[model samples]
Target: MLKKLSGLSGIAIIAILSLQTNAFAQNIVIPVETQHNALVLQTNKSNNLNIVYVGPTLTDKKEYEEVAAQYRQTDEYTGVSNAAYATTGSRSLFEPALTVTHADGNNSLDLQYVRHEAKKIDDNVSLLTVDLKDPIYNFEVRLFYKTYFKEDVTEQWSEIKHAEKGSVVLQKFASAGLYLKADNFWLRQYHGDWAKEMQPEESKLTHGIKTLDSKLGTRADLFQPPVFMVSLNKPATEDEGTVLYGSLEWSGNFRIDLELDNQDNLRVIAGINNHASPYTLQPGEVFTTPAFLSVLSFHGKGEASRKLQSWARNYKLLDGKGSRLTLLNNWEATYFDFNETKLKALLKDTKALGVDLFLLDDGWFANKYPRNNDGAGLGDWQENKAKLPNGIASLVSEAQANDVKFGIWVEPEMVNPKSELYEKHPDWVVKQPNRQEYYFRNQLVLDLSNPQVQEFVYNTVDNLFTKNPRLAYIKWDCNAVIYNAYSSHLKNQSHFYIQYVQGLYSVLQKLRKKYPTVPMMLCSGGGGRVDYAALQYFTEFWPSDNTDPLERIFMQWEYSYFYPAVSSSNHVTDWGKQPIKYRTDVAMMGKLGFDIVVSKLDAKDLQFCQEAIKTYNNIKPIIWQGNQYRLQDPAGNAVAAVLYLNEEKTSGVIFNYLVNNRYAAGSERPIRLKGLDPQKRYQLKELNLYPGTISSINSNKTYTGEFLMTVGYNPDVKAGRASVVLALNVIMENS
Candidate 1:
């Protein structure tokens, strides 16, 4: 019998029950659904679980059952097409999600359906766990699925347990495996290096395996973030096709494999990369993989991104719904050469610009091995008496006097060879027993895998907050990559990569619990540590070190496809020769900040910056909590535009940037806006317009949202005047 619980806002809550069978073959079906999406799993007569469907919600249970029945395999070759968690050495031949060598020397695994359970965590979320066991060995695997009803997102992970007397070698353990059947598949991936991060690359899937992975154990996201999107039957677009997207919640070495089988089914397996790191599970021991979050959208990549952003803000990120403070960092301003007097002057400038927070970046620490440059004083956390005679408390007091908050930067996970900390604990760093040590930025990675190192890292933050209780923010940086990859504390060095991430997470979790409200920014040379697992503890992330405005336009555009703009710290720096207004306009797309020396700004530039800050404060709500639409792609056109529409579709903002004018002959075409209420009228106004710049559209005109969305307005941009930001508000009528 099918029973229904009381629903919430038209969302049906179906009771989980197994259908009875009179014959020998038993059939089971489990439907995990949110408001907008559904993931249905079914078991065939052989007791093998398979994913029957994963797409928009199928409200009719009978319809989905019929769909599942139609997919019953009659041939052995196609049996693995819809496998829920394919394993090695079964009848399957695909890339297995779980691979283990048993203690008795058997390498093959055949998992059978044992039982399952489903429960609601709250009104907005539900969890489902399916238990599977090997018919021969004493090995078991439990797959978990957590669905967010309102956000239309599903999170999946796996737990493996062994009951054998000896130990089992686990080679591959994927968090989640998804199977989709489509006529054609197009994969969109984000990849880049150092300052050039989050660059999007799209490719069509053929009959082979496509792998995206990271071997940089510590700064995993330096080359690529553990996230991707796949469009069905067509090239990916912002708002027009069926798209599936997912992201891994691990900050260590991870891998994503997209394999297109001969049966025209695309299988996606994602989890921690087991490259040269095979874990051993003892008797009664359980190993759990990190969560893999995913969403399926019928309306296209735009809808998928909006759902993910909503989930991240409402559930995953720390204080994600709150607005970020507009900060000014001193890295580009003074570099590593500032004292109490210079810093207090910078605080006055910060107050003059109306910035909320002032960050004292590097160079404020160490006495014997001062951080005068990037080559020293990384792990040492004590304030340099020579640089600031009164310590960090004096700066905090000065910032309070100027009505601005104080923040400081620290690279706690790195140690310079010239520092006292490394000399004190030589074995605390990650290095092979006798091999040569490789250095990056003249520093080595601290072994977070060791408990002593974890304690030291935690105390570094505790001491800062204890000494200066009014410290408003912290910029935690990791400048060194894992080069030696060896941990002396562990009996098996193969566990170094996984244990190091766990150790880092342990330290962050403690800090988050201690200082529940302090905002922290995660930076790893640049966007290297921008994964969800780390974001849970930090408030925002520095997207890149290169603060060039033109480069940021394209970089932030690609970043917005997955992450929310509110958590991205974009700064206006002196890296490029672009105009002050142009630089400010680009940085305004995300959490606004300034990295240049404000004291050196000319009179006109200073006035423009202060006014621009005021304007950003007025429209930040729309940028932070709204649906983003890529009106134009920078890769395909000379001019790129982006629009943000509030939840109610009442007010919005649009920013357009001119990349180059050499091939911009037809760049004056009016771009059709998106996500607007057709019945209302909007008044448009230009903001932060450069002096003497010609307006592309009539800024004083009022147009119906229907007309604005269909016909649109031209963004006439030229080389001299490179960018424009327009604000739109509802034109209220006399009701």
Candidate 2:
């Protein structure tokens, strides 16, 4: 049953295997809006390691009801995950208790986790220990996790992590691999009880950022950077990699291999023109790749990633050049009536979108202007002047005489009790200056550790970037949700969980170190501050303002498992209530922008948004640089695509999508392409059902291939929506 509890051990290892595996096992069924559900885990692997989880008895950490409290009920009331309710314990929520220790002898493995402390939130008792070691074995199952935050409630700690965070390439095992390290820099990064402040002579200066194979040359594909520890001497709490500051800074590492003799449960990868190929795995064979994630730190190990390379010469993305400028967003064309000639006709449609950013969100400096629904006059940043009687530096010099680049929108960490900055700093907000003040969206938060409200939200973005030098993209919105959880900059409530995540990482590292390269994009109310450590200094990530293409295929397949489609933007909306070539082919696999009214799109949806913006800028140099393959199709789930070839195979782009309505009568479904050019031959084009009939495809496995070929994306036989395109021809062979 998990392979007869994988190769036994024990007192015969828990007396003849936990009384013959859960007393002749049986009952283990699942269903109910589940995303992932792996856990048959019961490992103990030879040379006597250790094991014990037992199960249930959570006792309220806030009525965290159950995960496995008496469970043998298949959907007996949508069984678990009411968002796994738990203010305290009973975290089965996707079980885990794996153990793998190897040793030919000379033993030591007394590992005893034993968690049964029902509501242990503050009376504190959730001990997690890892002593893993192995030339042979002391502990090394090495990979298996689940928990994307369960509860911190001001660090009362009911934690769980891993529902997405990446570095891919795990299990091929031609040798040994994998080297995770999380003692948050060996022992503490703003969390507490580093084994009770290990005074073994304290130390600190750990900065990090260097692996992909020594700053760019690559080699890592075994299980992954799994030692994610953060204890900055205990405080800042929020899991899924929350780099709290002041100490401990353990770098990152996730290397892979050691496919413990591959009993292959599946691992077929290569698709979209290595033709008809898509599916992946090898770690109980899972499958999923393409990772750039916001990894705040990870400089080495996995044997310093075989001396890495490729940081892409000074990692820059869009250039108007640092502190650049081109802003104008009135929520996709005035959601609130603006007075100044409909706000100078959207700054004359923002000087014809050529650039010079002009932003003006949330009906301007409140006081019942957009006719107040909330936030009455929000810390008064002035100039409503009857909704702009030519003020705000005359609409910032009428958007610098239409050259464009003006900004405005401030929740200034909120306050709105009908306004006047909470009738004058209602104790500057996050109360305990005596009871009651916690409101969610109607608004309240402020106390930015109070340095006079972080110098009034930094003198209101430095007096609008000191009277606008074309003030750029700062769509830094946060609409609100972290309720009344007080924090007058900490003294209690368990030291306000490291000053509420060090006061939102100190106003986002001082608004990105005083606007370094002003191309910000971390909008909250939209994909709620899309994660991956707010992409180390936010460059771009809106992912969801809900541009709906069948709700962006599970929101861009759950943010393309660890984001990076040129930091993902995807807008192109003008009301395609359903199917506009399947929402511009799911916004041409990212970095594809547009928000309606190019004269309300019609000439065949404006020639399919100009051939989906010239097949997304002719595969914008391989969807902004390639090697992204995300497919898992073994004649199942009919199809879903995300290919991005380009490790010098000249170029690539396979974006495919087609949810199995099954097509066998005249079957034609080949798609096995990934990082192609087994010797040049591609040129395929379908860029949104255009002038069809093009195919060249070639590739015969550099790691996988059969090189498929079958095009007929249903569009009543073409020129309306079905698509495909493959292009290679770059083989400068020199080996």
Candidate 3:
């Protein structure tokens, strides 16, 4: 008979037993450590791995052993242990990491410890793989933990394989599972609709499960992004307490489950949502889930964001070190109503304003169907001969003549019933056999699960680049979400969602390989498909369609929590009553661009626009490649400020916006800066100031960094939608 293990004696016996069995180690400890964080796992006497501790880095092996011993006590009633990779039908009563039906129709899965391996990939990266297997079946699971030492981030995913002769059904498979123990858990999640994306909201986790999910098959970010932040012991602040932040690197249906178990343990399970997706594993088949990136920060959410931004720039994003060009997109300006002559006029204005690129958005395609509106000509990729008798090459040459690079938009993954391509290949759209098809923006989602459809999408991009060698950029847009998601190409209907996303990734990977240097922007009806997986192929993304400066102040602030400013494309548009200078100020915070017709601006506004673009170009390096500090959050404060300091801390820029008139509530308070060299002397100058407005700071005065950071500097922004941008440079006594 087996006796229950407890205390130090139990740990000692388990350690001795581990020496006997090499494959099934009963008491082996595995440490996945970054520079500042550590996640330690150990096997219990029951041959199950459990997360012992996740906090500050533990230096020695003895510390890991001690933590494991401390957690060895079993519950009096349930006797359930907190398995690191919890599975169904084992002793786990909480939400399991995985659930599956075996070949014998048994849904029970009892995973036991098999082995683990650690490998140092590079000077700054390491890999850890833990292997687990069912004691009764041939099913196997391998958990991968990749650590970026300097970034303080660890990416986790899982691979499932089976050797059974018959097929096994996968009901649910999570990308990662994190178990935490704290007195109180506070969660921060993002929620919004089409125009208002990435709005932050915080709430306390009580007794049950709190799920943040997205079921929109393609537009997963339309409701909630697969990201979250959890603070232990108290509400999360910018720079106060311990915070755990993570994001799922997937662009499909995703779900994040935060469960507060009866034992007061918090379990976080995140991955692709299994709503209508149940994959089957044939004999000798293996399946891999998407990666979930996470980091543990004792320095609060501010440091967490910085670490994630650093990791993305250094490793994840495409051309992460490169800067984005300022382009003028014609969507809001021309709106599919321009010809070659009109486009050339816009290009002339773009060059005069010092913008780097000109983007032609939509309505450049279709001959028979004529893309005059969203109801027609989506799948048709041919040039609209009626709109421009000279074709796209003429516009490309015109843009080149103006010394500006050119880009065009394409919605390759969508189709309209009125288009020639759709009329010829109606079977290519995602639809059920007997059900009516649903339309979004008068378009249907292309069935990318079909190899023929995937080939067409890939060629749509390849042919354009092959024809126009001088084409500098591609704005890849997807305007519709998957509605009748049944795919005729899929063998099993349940495999549609997963296969479609895989097919999309395959197309993007091929395009990236072919056009390695060309830049691409991922826009899915505005902020719909902004995930790390899609961002791996694209250089930047359109944060929102609503270019209202007031709305963008809050939207961009929340977005900065996870993504860097370089990956966001903000455009000054004619959508609101805000001043052109105010609109330009908000747009300059990210990759600067213009969506309004330059010719329509008055002389005063146009001159200010030119100067603002010049200022943005001059300081683009500091804004793009800098550490961001949220001096004042726009959630409740009347004055919202953001500071971007370069890595050297010698130069920086500050953007302050008076969100609303608070009747002198926050006017007198000065904005205290961060990430500055306290001992160094610095000089400040105001950039892009309104003509009639007075300067808030004494631009002629030189101040010490210590005084600037401690006493702070007030921009004295006025009530009705005022803004300011200040440039900072270290002062050299020798100069």
Candidate 4:
């Protein structure tokens, strides 16, 4: 009943069935259009669709179909490796594409493929639907792949519709099952902890299954960031090499599995966490999974990353208003000890340091219980009258009088057991009916799954904004992940994870609509919720609580691959013994901010800080909105460098950091920059006034972009720790 398609290679055509010359050939060739390239799926002799080519442009060449039908055949029929609706009892033993639990408790989905259809939903979007049905149970599923031609990304998810006389439960369903060649394929993932997030890890793909998942009910947990990439075993440099990457646009528990089959075919399965998740569907009911965005790049990992970054900035993330503001957060300056006078003094120093926004983080709320510590007053949103008798309005007024914007911090999704809100709505927290609640960080997560609870959270934030009309920004922090995951109102307890995220999304959407102008940031104690889904709601993300520039070089390098610089809020913290210029240089690469005590620095250090802030403000437009390139791998080398170039290639900046490592041999290496118009000549110079503290280049000179990229710029890094910032301007265009 099935033909075996064989002879598939890296860009090789698979032949399953011999087709006679006919007009129907056009129907067999499926072409998906995207912003950067086209993905062509051609049906072979097996009557199944397989990817033939994914490249720069769409082609209707007849030879593509002919070659697809001309490949060698096999005797055994194990079904196609790239099964659109791979089900139970199939030849494949990896994760099933669809698992349907019948009313009789039998778990099997025997689907027979019917046909495939395509539709142009919009000028910039195309939709492909593959139809499959179970012959015995009358269950049907439409696997969908939507492509945004301008975003250079494809999204996949499935919609299941049941016509069975009885009910069925959808146990496991993957948003996409991408099949790729297994020859020398490598998997790259980002792993780290609370302070050190987005650390890149790479390994070669071997036999068996390798999975990356987040089950802590948070998307970007301490162990894993919500992204996976695969490239050739020998990856090319930043500008060249073929790579493929995918990410789930969900903030809740999710899983991504990569399995290499016996025939050396790699299958990537990604969707919601199905470990304990099961959705029951009654007769005439339907279920749909969240989309999994997948991108392919023939050029290199950098190109693939740029595609995702462009899509995120242009469509997903909040639109920017020119350059970002240099903010000064008071958390590090005075932790819970500041009053009106102290804060006023800090504001004057912040204004003197060229800070445009003043953010007052945690410990400013609560009247019944002091929020001086994390153990009390989390759910309380009122300003502490004892700490600030003049109230938050006066603080906002003070900031405005100093010509700086004002912002406040809040953790609306969590509650302390000692708070008034928790005492009144004890049942609102996430906990089982009979089990004792286990608190994380002395705080219990509010059950946003409940609609009434969501309304309360919304009102709390809305009232805060209503009370303080001058509040221009909000630091929305979620310090703890959901544990003891149980919702009292939901009977299907397994759906708690899914419903909790939905409720959180509802609250965020409501707040975004109510306060369109005020930008809110996403922070999960630091970098836990920094995913594409969260970016749609928040304007920027705090990369980490650890502001050590040495650690940040690797963190920002991996983080910027999928996200633009504007999405990251980097702060210069006063880590003991670290130089101020080194910290300032690291933070200036992204959305620069100061998390140190501005009033405590000496006159010399303060002058350096003032000059650094001015330099960042002058070049922030290129840093925030430009194409970034990791010039050197910070993890592998002691000398790390990163370059940012604007769209026009007229201006750019490069930051070089030399770490103090015993493994470092004190060898000087040429740092080649990328993302430049090779025909143009550029002039590079160090931005700082401090002599010999930070070296810009081996030779202070001008060179063509081609020579800079090919010949390279070597920075004079001493044996000790040091950092330098280079400002580049276009001098001439050879073209």
What C-alpha lDDT do the candidate models reach, one value each? Answer: 0.86, 0.40, 0.86, 0.77
Off by over 4 Å in 4: 1-27, 35-38, 42-60, 66-76, 89-92, 104-106, 111-125, 320-323, 661-667, 691-700, 719-721, 733-735
Candidate 2 residue lDDT tens string, 44-111: 22211221111121333222223334334234221211211101012222211211111222222222
Model 1 ranges with Cα > 4 A deviation = 1-23, 68-78, 663-667, 690-697
lDDT score for candidate 1 against the true structure: 0.86
Error of 4 at 82 (Å): 0.9
lDDT of 1 by residue, 229-338 (tens): 99999975888899998889998999999998876779999999998789988989889999999988888788888898889889988888997899999988888889
* 10 residues in a row with least lDDT, candidate 2: 213-222
Q: What is the TM-score ranking, best to worst?
A: 3, 1, 4, 2
Give the CA lDDT, 0 to 100, for residue 290 in model 4.
78
* 281-382: candidate 4 lDDT, tens digit per residue: 888877777788888887777878777777777767876433456799999888887788888887887799898899899899898988988899999888
lDDT of 2: 0.40
Model 2 TM-score relative to the real fold:
0.31
What is the per-residue lDDT of model 3 for residues 56-84, given as tens digits with 9 covering 90 to 100? 88767577788744653336253334678
lDDT of 4: 0.77
Q: How many backbone clashes does candidate 2 have?
A: 67
